[model samples]
Target: MSEPVIWREPVVEEWIDYNGHLSEPYYVLVFGHATDAVMDAVGLGPAYRSEHDASLYTVEAHVRYLDEVSLGVDLEVRSSVIGVTGKLLWIWHEMYADGRLRATEEVLGVHVTGGSSSPLPDEVAAAARALLVEAPEEASGQIALRR
Candidate 1:
């Protein structure tokens, strides 16, 4: 995996269920937003949406919370391509605050045609392949886990 990619911002309202920290659901939201950024980086953005009638859908996700993320903390999510085969892409992410690791998530996504799970067009696959990062071997773990 490569360096983590900092995200836009985490809104104050995102800090729900505060026993003095961000809620569980918000972590997923943060990761989701980061994934959107990845999609854009891989050439699947608004233009792709308007022109190709294609998109990606999450098939599974496993997240591990390593530490608490308190309110007002500045966090960034880093992602890397773990694996890609046929229509499936496996990705790994880590969330950090002030350079400290707080959480990690692994996701499996399927490139689809419109809302269906049909295989992605060759062009789309090629674009995504261009952005894939080589993952380390022996990176085995649960595909979905919650802290």
Candidate 2:
């Protein structure tokens, strides 16, 4: 089996917040790029979107911030395609820095064409299925408040 794809980016000064760490929005930004990387891997990237006028649209998402990320850190986001149907896809991302998991995100998206949900093309669907993996235990859960 081929190794899973990993996306990487360094945190920039502009991404830092007043708390002196990676900003919340930037975490989402990196996760979004990781999603794009998945699209590219599965043949649903920019070129395909332009040629076919179809793309993936996120329908729901959940993110957990587990640790602080400092500026200039090389962030690695390990992404997995946990599930896929005709039109729906589920992805999970684990963000790490200094070999520690700093955050995670889970997203649900739909293949869309002409502004409507549509089935993925045969080739793209097959490629996505090939990348399928079992969902991580930490993937889906609501945050609980500490009493």
RMSD for all candidates, in order, please. 3.5, 1.3
Off by over 4 Å in 1: 1-6, 11-14, 136-140, 143-147
Tens-place lDDT per residue, model 1, 1-147, is 345344656537547574777788888998888888777766667788779787778998888888888777777898776777778877777888867989888888898777777665666567556667776442456455777
Best-matching candidate per lDDT: 2
Task: Kindly report which residue stretches of model 2 are placed more than 4 angstroms away from their true locations once superposed.
Answer: none
Compared with the true structure, all predictions reach lDDT values of: 0.75, 0.92
- Give lDDT for model 2: 0.92
- Compose the digit string of candidate 2's lDDT tens values, residues 1-147: 334569999999999999999999999999999999999999999999999899999999999999999998999999989998999889989999999999999999999998999999889888988888888898779889989
Query: Where does the lowest 10-residue lDDT sum fall in candidate 2?
Result: 1-10
